[model samples]
Target: MYPFNCSQSTTTTCNASLYHATSLGRHDSTRQIATYYSVNETQLHPITGIHNRQDYLVTVPCSCGTVSGTTAYFHAVNYAVQQGDTFSDVSAEVYSGQVWVVGDEKQRFVAGNNVTMNLVCGCLDGKGTEEEEGEVIVTYTVEDGDTLAASLSRVVGLNELLTQNPGFIDVGWVLYVLKGSQVGCGDFEKGYFDAEGPVRYNIEEIEEATNNFDESKKIGEGGYAKVFFGILRGQEVAVKMMRSNKSKEFYAELKVLCKVHHINVVELLGYASGDDHVFLVYEYVRNGSLSDHLHDPLLRGYQPLSWSARTQIAVDAAKGIEYIHDHTKTRYVHRDIKSTNILLDDCLRAKVADFGLAKLVERSNDDELIATRLVGTPGYLPPESVKELQVTSKTDVFAFGVLLGELITGKRALVRDNKEPGRLKSLITTVSASSTHLRITLKNMDILCIKMVQPVSDLVRNLSGSSLEDQFRNWHASSLFSSYPI
Candidate 1:
């Protein structure tokens, strides 16, 4: 794993203190500390710039501080290199029901000396799984000499734990137990609605809104659904109608989308269901999409987007994605994030659309990389997603990086290579092949491309991208966009 400056870590509270980590593994020589886990840099200021794990003792962030309000970090640094994970000192009191990293499932952590516990905390009291009701779903990184059995035994039975986990759990590494090992509520039961917050619109109200699905009101079309502009109770709305009878398919997507609400995310005004179709209504965004302004020839010359406008749009979109990843009642991974999906308002502010399109993880762990058929734009798809057909929050971050490249350089994620007309070059490979101090010209805007390009290029290359929260915070605070100085 690469090391980065933990100046701006991803953790929301960050109430924990610093750990001076010395890497026992090799990392990219050029890796910046900003890429992975966040830590307070004040106490143990990390050595930044031009360093590698093989050559030097690079300090890493082992700050297992706070995982939201209810929990604290359980640093499991001291373990007795045993055959299997043993009970630890922290678990002496009582604890159970926290899932480990879903990506690296069933691996033994005996060989690891300094096990890095990077738990993406998802703790919202009322939002826990219906089956897991009062029991919270927060992950705890076990400290060096702690055993969780005592606490876990009190919380849940040994038989229940064995049945849910079903196999051996590695010590030092995180072994969590969420109440249930399941997917979305809808994935199992077809017609059930979590029905937490989103409104349900009657079929007649929807018909009146779109004039009975009139072709004249059509605004968009794709494999997923058909979009129509409508007036719902005097409020202008965009209704997305998907033709399918699988109410089970609609359950998870609708439930996840309903709970998400932020200024940057496109609001799900309500939903409707017909025998053969599903309708999702959203607040209408007048300015179309960032793709329309950046890539469409018809709009580009007519109303060229200002660099100032581009930066704000990027910031707005970043915040929207970050919200779903970290701050939501249940953290979600946006399966498809692309330029067209980012809608622009009349004021040019961005509202991330198609978030409801995100598929739920097969299991409870939010950050787990669930394997499935790969679905994303060609150039925007990260290497891991393409290779493994698995997706996580990182998938969206990778796509957002491509979007950033498009904003800075006015290029599509995939472009027809001028040298080889038959081959399409990706933004990641193209930008990564460039020298550090490059310059570009766009719409009489003599853009200084060198500084801005590094961050964009790093992201497009999928270099351990920072969480949307960290990236958004860094992007807004950056002064590298010389052309669009705030």
Candidate 2:
């Protein structure tokens, strides 16, 4: 179906729009109504919302025209579902993995027959005028465990997130979130302003905060960095300490960290350098990590995450990964994406952390496919990353699938090693059939992930952001593999 195109000379002027679309199912938070009427993918500027100078709500444009001497703002089309059409993947080729038509729309999609679709739109008139003093309102039908913070992820931060979306959001409640090209909020509002540049701290400040690198102040540690909990101007923050002279990694990490600013991704507040040591300060997430809550809650002194929480965590982490993969100027492959790297706040909201292993993908004949030395936690890496040593965006996708399995089964990616006592077994071998709740769905999945010690590559590549929520409704998590050889 082609769009109803009109010349600029004949096109009519329509004021600020208030388009409304309903999510018919409980699992999906967002859905797209097929608008064959749009001539192209046109980006629309902010219309109704009361936005500050910095952030602008990003949206797509729609056409409006007069009919029977009355102005009508609507677009529709008739479409016959094809053979392979399904509810979430209807017939939109460009909008794959985001087709969330349900209820009557679900029936129409399943019938493989002709069905009419349209965009519902209207405007709230104020004082006899089409203008209004409000943002574009999108009404969402809340699911079982949707909190206001969950909607705030990837959209905005602290003050902006709270102010724009006030009141508690619960199941079956309607929740709204603001979106824009520059619309965002900082991690915290107390010590710093929103969208403030990363601060360059004096090394003495970090030394005093950590009490001269005292081990007692340490909160977390990794292969490359040690994390310490400290307070910065009445606000709690996590300071990661590392060696600056190690490799290109420190500079690379700073470069990558400064460029990204999304709610799902962890926020870097400032940094310091002295005596060949570097300190990176970040907003301290209250909860520990996804790995802690999932594996053994009783021993870890935490409660097991509910099924809904697991699903939400997956969605939130996916949004973070998707931001780095798609939104950044030079796309990066987060070489490390595991349950441990996903930290949670007091609200149990997930944010992706640690970009030390992240590699900037410079596409070329040699760089794109070049092999690097093996680095990453076991059980999360794929065959291409392990054997080929090739680091690409697909590597993160593979690790994420394993992380999803961890969320489902509450089992570590790698089990005890059978080949060598006190060692580890293949990651693919351990986690593939770990959960009775989930089983393999695809034949290629078995061949690639389970049958061999091989793990997920492109199996979960299609899954991202809110799509993870939609995936659980339909397919089981695919198999996983190891970064190490069997």
Candidate 3:
């Protein structure tokens, strides 16, 4: 048992006593505790009659013989004012009971002033417990020298990765090692050695096809390349072996040709680049060139193109040019447009062949114009092109006009005729002299609906002025017409 005391007011006194006893083997033992004390305090306030000094004690028994304990006496000034009470009023009320001594600092907390009260206490035992764990997940880590394609092949199963993420894999995969010992996959940097596409063929395969570019296999030759008929993978192909190093123009032409899949444009199968050689593989066109058929007099009698056929060829060529100008993302200008550059397939369909001189328009600036060294066939070149007047699409139009004139007259733009000095000059002179007669014939047919005869007589008179009659007489004497047996 423990003794306890209760006291209040400035001069107070209280006392308590505790007694405990336990009997064992018929022998009795007892213990007693008593306390008498007076607590001192100062005057609190002038208002309330309550005391600020108070004390209380409690007693309990313990297992060991009777134990006693005492608590320190303390003065607690506790006064709770009702709502709407001013701090001064609360102080006054507290002092009236002599429970507290009001000071200037206590007066600062006036009524209607926001104030917060905080309580602090101590506990003997306070603790907390924790919860259980969850399941664990497993993953693999990519080490150094790993690629994105390889990592994906391992993580998601190789078959699924190949089928589901083909596009990602084909974009040249990359792997990055993170700071936390993790790995990531993405596209590789451009121009890196690993960024190249899969090789379709090796140098050995191409060499065997061309017979090591033997002179015997060479079918045609150009300014910078030689074309050979080669068998690649059991298929006939025309392989052009470039004579010079790679240039931006060559790559640009290749990019354009790859995208141009029109029937009227030559098809590009594939290209190969090596340390010392560059090769372009294209589909072989069996028929030769338009120039061969047109210029070789021996072949003319065998195949004389009809006017309708000529018109169709011109229209097809125009459509091909229009496509190059309109359909592509970049406008292409064929700086060289001539008959020799046009090839005819087995069906006599024309396809524009050479693109080495083509140029791509880069920007939308109006002042932009493509300028180059003088490079074109003299006879087919336009007058403006000769003077270099900022060549444009109109220059190609002028060249086409010359080709049309050639198809009509069946004569080369520039021909060497010794009988008539300066052939183009003489041709122009002859045409000018007969222009009046030709115009009258056309006019009569248009207005009078009459087939004129004097126009023919004027043509005969114009021919009589030159040595053309003598040439015709000698042609009649030759036996070239005797085979007709007429």
- TM-score per prediction, in order, is 0.52, 0.54, 0.45
* lDDT over C-alpha atoms for residue 450 of model 3: 17
Instruction: Give the worst 10-residue stretch by lDDT in candidate 2.
Output: 37-46
lDDT (tens digit, per residue) of candidate 3 on 286-310:
6655665456535544375544555
Q: Which has the greatest TM-score?
A: 2
lDDT of 2 by residue, 142-231 (tens): 334334444355333212433355444444332233322121223321111112347898988887877777889888988878999887
TM-score of 3: 0.45
- Give Cα distance to truth, residue 294, candidate 1, Å: 0.6
Model 1, range 181-270, lDDT digits (tens) per residue?
A: 221211121111111245689989999999999999998876677899999888799998887754544665677766654557776768
2 or 3: which has the higher TM-score?
Answer: 2
lDDT per prediction?
0.51, 0.54, 0.41
Better of 1 and 2 by TM-score: 2
Best of the two (1, 3) by TM-score = 1
